[model samples]
Target: MYQPLAYRLRPKTLEDIVGQEHLVGPGKIIRRMVEANLLSSMILYGPPGTGKTSIASAIAGSTSFAFRMLNAATDTKKDLQIVAEEAKMSGTVILLLDEVHRLDKTKQDFLLPHLENGRIILIGATTENPYISINPAIRSRTQIFEVHPLTPEAIEMALDRALTAKDGFKDEDVILEQSAKRELAFVTNGDLRSALNALELAVRSTPKNEDGTILITKEIIQECTQQKGFSHDKNGDAHYDVISAFQKSIRGSDADAALHYLARLIEAGDLISICRRLLVIGYEDIGLANPAAASRTLDAVLAAERLGLPEARIPLSVAVLDLCLSPKSNSAYQSLDRALQDVKNGKATTIPNHLKDSHYKGAAALGRGLTYQYPHEFSDGWVAQQYLPDPLAHTRYYEPKFTGRYEQALAKRYEELHQKKSSSTK
Candidate 1:
């Protein structure tokens, strides 16, 4: 069998693991569990290629326990029965179940008794959200640890280890340039497996020179992965991930990283998605920080749509950079959500009679707008009156976050306009 480079170069021990320090680092939960040889059933959850299976394999090797691998998708109850029988024959079993959330109710039910008796130590790996997809009974038996995505630096470290490992290309005279390494790391989007696979393809496919040294370049890496490390399906999980990263980078004020993902989206010919997501990031994430920025981003998005692909990126990038450098606040979205939640939970009450629509005929006859106070007649166009329903007359939802100059002014005005006696004095 031609094993992939990622599998061959998988981290064999807990110490060898590169990313996910929260779980595997010294004094961390998983590492401490391994050091004491006190293994328990664990369900590792995260995106693909984030080392969930690798960690399970590392635990089995370190503990000297008999390791068995199974896929929930293909394996049946009968296969699990065999594993259980093996656990009885042997001392203990470390079962690495990949895509474990797919295991049906019957298999999950069978797993509980074995887990309780400590006959089989289950190490399930899944890309889906385990809490939502996995059987609750299975979750109750296992410690759930979410594996975070590897950073570019972590991915690059894995690539380097593969290039020099004894089981890897250590014997081969491979010349990987620095630029190629960075590009590969950036393009993989924190997926170490993708990085190793791309490197393997690039190295094996490239022609050797007269000196028998295989040279790997930036172009070669791009050719293998396609479109300069922008291997994204517009409709896939990767597309959502990149868009999320892009928006978060901008919110974090990391202009360079934001621009990099923006470029990636453009390369994938996903201009419309980018434009739409940028609008959301501007208003939702960058809300109240610079209110003008949201409208400006909308204008920029319109321009990008009008200009189209090749040149559309120009305006889109401008908006991304602006949003990246701009201050960020989610107060608007959060406050609106608070109000929405209250309404959804039956907090919505009758509209104040004075504040009802009175422009229509006979609205006054119903005493709808009779007692309404005109704010313009009061000083500074500000009159303290009930605008919300009677049940929520004093409920304040939209509180301004003093982030940017614009929101700072809003904060002061909001405080003055709302602070008053228990009831409206008007």
Candidate 2:
């Protein structure tokens, strides 16, 4: 049976692991543990292909502990029992639990005692944030370490090693171009497993030249990965991640990063998501700080909608650039939210009697509008009167921001009105 290149290239020792220098580098925590031959239960969380499993395997390999792999979601309690039995017989078994965030209460209970006793050194792996997804009982017992995506330089280094490694194309005559290596390294977006697999596929599928050497080109790498990083999966976790990055980039005023994520969304054909998020960012982030820019954002979104697709990206790009460069303020929505929270808490809801409708005949009998003072009838077209209910007569909301000239002017008028209201009440 032929093993996959990634499987064949699994890191057999801590020294062999690539990337994640923070955890695996010299003088790092994991490296120190391995050097001292003291292994503890750990949860390694990160995106897939970032070497969570590889790190687990390397730990077991280095420590000389019995290694076993199982899926927390698919495996039953009986499967865990088997590992427990093996730990009894072998003294200690290093169990690499995949998708550990899905471990149910029953399995977690069964595994806890074993982890405590050190009979089974648990190396839980997950692609989700363990703090949010994993049960607290299990979390409290294990040391959680985060794994990050491998850098392009790290991937390139791995590709270079794979070219000459015994299990790779060392036996066969193959020549890999520098451009091809860089393309393979980059197109996978820091996914070393994907890069290795794509490299293997390219090497195997291409025919040998007259000199009997398989020459791999950048085009070959792209063909192998089928557009790789350029193509976005709209239904995957990466989709939401990209959307989050898109909005945050704009909010942070990083125009380049915003455009990069926007381009990804565009390529994925997620015009609806792109347009909706842009509209939200315009108001929620730009708000009173740059009202005109917010209005222009809506206009750009409308243009994009009418244009649709390839042409739509043009207008969307212009809108994203504007929003990123515009002054940001969330005060408008934040003030509304503060008022909403008061209402939800049952702080105040009744309208003042004076402000109530009095156009109806029976309203006067109910004392509605009895003390009403119409602002239009006043000389200054303004009057200070109780607008809030008795319980919240002095309640104030709508705190204007001063991040831009527009909001600064609004803030000035707001203070003036507040002062007039305060003096009249006195």
Candidate 3:
């Protein structure tokens, strides 16, 4: 039977591991733990194709303890009890659980007693967030090590290793063109297993010419992995990428691209999440410039909530288009960011004494509200006064952007106030 290329090229040792040099390198955390045989319960958290299973296998093979494997997706509470009993009899059993987040609350809770007693050194592999899915007690007992997605360079290196390794492509003389390789990497999106599978499929499908050399082209690579792409799931890198693209499209004033990305998310059953995010972005990115953008987003979210899927898509499309076409300004967001930084860096100035309360007892005795002027009593219904503290009186935090209807009025009012203040001071 022919083994899959990914399985055939699986790394057998720490040195054979393709990526994650930060953990498995010489004198690293994993190396130190393995060397001292002081293994603790650990959670391997990362996306797919990052070698969580391979690392567990390497640890099991290298250690002297008996190794047992189970999948949380299928295992029961009784199954966990059996493993716990066996580990109690055995000196130290390394229990490797795959998809540990799939275990229900009861099944996950079953491992706690064993884990606390040190009966088994649990190594859990999960694609989901452990904090959210796993029990807090289980999480507290384990050392969480985050495994990152493979970089493009790492994927390329793995492909090269697979081509030349004794176990993989030994007899095949398949050479991937530079363009084909780049396309394959891009399609895989840092998934090592997917990259290898694509490479294997490309090599197997390509017809050799009379020259006896098979050329893998970009077209063939694209054909191997169907290019009918969809928006990302809510919990992974794709989620971040799609949202980033959506925001960038709006910021770049590409209404078409913004609409396209919105449609992609809506069609992928992410309408509710997309609506919520749009509402947030409308306020955060498009605040006050076109305040109506935020209202439109809220309407979209309400429409999605009330009507649900399929029918709610109309409002979602409208909201996305309105946000994209709305007058854009990030000045308020940037000003808040600067103000927050100043506060964080201990640059927050005190409130001016005139703005302090004089109605409270003994407040007027401390010169509070001594020279405060009421704007309503003035000729122009505006007063000239130091609103900010003495130290930051000249600090200009909010600079209005002249883009939308609201901002235009705000700019005029601000200019009039400054003119009145200048005349009063003179």
Candidate 4:
């Protein structure tokens, strides 16, 4: 009759909840919603151990509405119909559906009508992105509340509760060293349930001395949790951690590290996510400086999707190599940042009249194209004229890097223009 430590230590109230104070604390959105009984259909989106289910349960238990629970992984349309029928009789039913994204389009459509009629207040829990997984119609009817992963501090608090809770380790004479507790927390990676489970196993495995005391040291916790298998399944912290490491490696220009992380994801059956991320990085990070990088990434995505794993490794390797070998530039990224900063500082410059559109009537009379020089009409396909707005005419925002095949020509053209302008000024 040994119950799981996570179950025994589950928070029973909002006050008992270990983390996410931002949402559940005083004056927060969720708090206001709960207190005011403005329980609209909502989607609680977050990774595991972020207390999605706990929040739903706390709200349902505290509210006046009748509550019902269902899991999309196992629940069927028939189950939903039964719940819908009961909800109609109850006036306002809070339907707590776990893994709501697991419901197919047909099943999700079944709830749309009832949701629209205000018969059921759907509180959904999904670890996946609602944009891709949840039906658009169903998602439209619900307010999306994002719940982030529990922080290390939050996980530590949960561990403390588990060690001392009556139903958890009250009967055991176990003491965990501070170092051992930190190690468990780190290994859990902000996963409260996993942390508690590791702590329970560590305590259980520790041998009691003849002195009648059991000690959980760093070594013991490490040993117990080290053997635990890690997965790259979409729902868990490992998924985010691996992808984060991969992105950081690319950003840092560590080709070897990027490849290693890519291999890890591939081995864990996360090929699709890996492919998708590569495509995103191509545009978001490796853009313009090396245009070929984006094209290569897109090709890899198509290859991975078409061929599937093992075989897909070929294209994955190609994409990673291209990203690693491509000349790095954050100029595009920096330009956007600079533009936003300019706007924030009230530096909106006026457009030069010469560069303004001259196709419209009265544009020529207003001196729109009076001094405008067409670059294509010049011998070198370059013209020395003011391109920037009047206020920012002397400001230079784009400074091309002298790296990569495409950017080398860009760098040369920029230098030539600068020389020409400097000579003319003298």
Error of 1 at 184 (Å): 7.4
- Residue-wise C-alpha lDDT for candidate 4, range 312-404, written one tens digit per residue: 999888888888777777666677778778778877877788878899899988988878888899898876777766666677777666556
Give me the runs in candidate 3 sitting further than 4 Å from their true place.
207-214, 228-231, 234-269, 283-290, 296-426
Residue 337 lDDT, candidate 4, scale 0-100? 79
lDDT tens readout by residue for model 1, 1-426: 899998997777998898999999989999999999898999998777889989988998898789999999998889999999999999799999998888888888888899999999999998777777888889999999999879999988888888899978999999899999999989887788888899999999999999999999999999988844445667545677888898888889999999999988998999888988999999887888898889999999999999999999988988988898888889988999999999999998888899889999999899998988898998788667778888887788987777798888888877777665333564
List, residue by residue over 147-204, the lDDT tens digit for candidate 3.
8788888888888888788887767777888888878776776678888888888888
TM-score of each: 0.69, 0.84, 0.65, 0.65
Number of clashes found in candidate 3: 0
Per-residue lDDT value at 202 in model 3: 84
The residue pairs found clashing in candidate 1 are none
lDDT of each: 0.88, 0.91, 0.81, 0.81
Comparing 1 with 2 on TM-score, the higher-scoring candidate is 2
Per-residue lDDT of model 2, residues 32-114, tens digit only:
98899888899998777889999998998898789999999999999999999999999999999999998999999999999
Q: Mark the regions of model 4 whose C-alpha exceeds 4 Å error after superposition.
A: 227-231, 234-426
Tell me the number of clashing residue pairs for each predicted model.
0, 0, 0, 0
